[model samples]
Target: MKVLLTYTSMTGRNEKIANYLADYLKEKGADVDLEEIIDTDAFGLTDYDAVIVESYTYHDGEVPDEAQDFYEDLADVDLERTKFAVLGSSSKKHIHFGRAVDYFTMQLNSSNGEQVSDSVKIDQDPDEDDFKRVRDLGDRVLKSLK
Candidate 1:
């Protein structure tokens, strides 16, 4: 399957998660294209069979500035044929932890993207348990293609 994994990270936590997911998906025999949200421009959802968007929430559950354009682009597109999942990282102390994932879920649903699994939210840095959840997430996405 053709998969695109994109993320925006300030402390690199999200980047690490994205990389792990990419590698795991590749190992599962997927053709994965990984990129940072800032480095991408005018991408279409139809280009890939599935997409995974990972992001860190900014103040009050807002999308980070670096990933705003990519978020907006996804919101603006028709994702009828795209299956996607969202991964969010945030501090558990925050009242809106994982709000970015919720936001992306709404946007993806609005744009007609098929949600392959429930969104994954990581509190702070990932640990062994978090890695297992991420791996399960990747497995779910890959399994959806069949």
Candidate 2:
């Protein structure tokens, strides 16, 4: 399946995690398209069989401005046939930790996209083990496609 992974990272932590995921998926033989949400002009959920939407926790449970554009770009895309999962990279100590994941999941589900896996919430200061878990998330999503 083709997997599109997009994310925004204010402090670069989420970007690192997104890259790790893309690498893992590629190594596993899945077709992967990884891009920073800020760098992409447009995207449609229908273009890929499955997608991984990710972001770092931003202000008070709000989606970052960069990702908002991409999400809005999805407006013209038919999502009912798409499967996706969300990943949130945040500091557990932050008041809004994991809020990005919650918001993204809600948006995707409300639009009729299938949720491929439970949202994966990574605490701040992710380590190698956390990286592995995040990579496994990609594997799990791929399995769901089968």
Candidate 3:
């Protein structure tokens, strides 16, 4: 399967998670395209069979500035046949932890994408348990495709 994994990270935590997930998916025999969400204009969701977006929650659970354009562009895109999953990182101190994942889930649904798995949220860096959860998420996405 072709899988696109994109992320926006401020302190590199989300990027690490994205890379880990990419490796996990690749081990499961998927063709993975891992990217940093710096240029949303060049991203085309239709080209991939499945997509996973990883982001770190900005202030007050908002999308990072770098990814905002991509978030907005989702409304104009057609994702009828693509499956999506969202992963987000945030500080546990925040009241709205992992809000970016929720926002992205809404956008994915509005864009007609099939959400294959529940969203994953991690604090700062991922631990062993977090990695396991991420792996299970990949498995779920793969299973959904079949």
Candidate 4:
């Protein structure tokens, strides 16, 4: 499976989790690509069978700036053939926790992208359980391909 992991991180928490998820997927024998949302291009997105969007929630339910363009570019894709999952990293203490994931999932669905299932949300101080959810998200995405 060709998978793309695109992420935007401000405090490095999201970056670390994105990398961890990428490594886990790679270990499972899936072809994975990791791109910082800011560096991603439209062409790169077409190459992946699945795209996992990772983002941090900012004030008032906003997605970070670095990923806004990446999210916007998603509208241009012919998403009928793609499978995707949204992984959100946020602090539960934040008022808008997991809101970015919700928005991205909605946007992707509106653009005709197939959602594997619900989103996976990791909290500020994620433990092993949080990591398991990430793995589960990957598993569900792969499952959809079959």
lDDT: worst 10-residue window of model 2: 37-46
What does candidate 4's lDDT look like per residue over 65-121, in tens digits? 878887787777667757888987888887888899998988888777888967988
- Runs in model 3 deviating more than 4 A are 41-43
> What would the per-residue lDDT of candidate 1 be over residues 98-137, giving only the tens digit for each residue?
8888888888888888999889999999999999999999
Model 2 vs. true fold: TM? 0.89
Residue 21 local lDDT, model 1? 91
lDDT of candidate 2? 0.81
* Candidate 4, run of 10 with poorest lDDT: 40-49
Model 3 CA lDDT for position 107: 94
Number of residue pairs clashing in candidate 4, backbone atoms closer than 3 angstroms, sequence gap of 3 or more or interchain: 0
Q: Provide the global lDDT of candidate 3 against the true structure.
A: 0.88
lDDT score, residue 53, model 4?
A: 90
Give the TM-score of each candidate.
0.95, 0.89, 0.95, 0.93
**Ten residues in a row with the worst lDDT in model 1?**
37-46
Quote model 1's TM-score: 0.95
Q: Is candidate 2 or candidate 3 better by TM-score?
A: 3
Pairwise lDDT winner, candidates 3 and 4: 3
Candidate 2: which pairs clash?
A: none
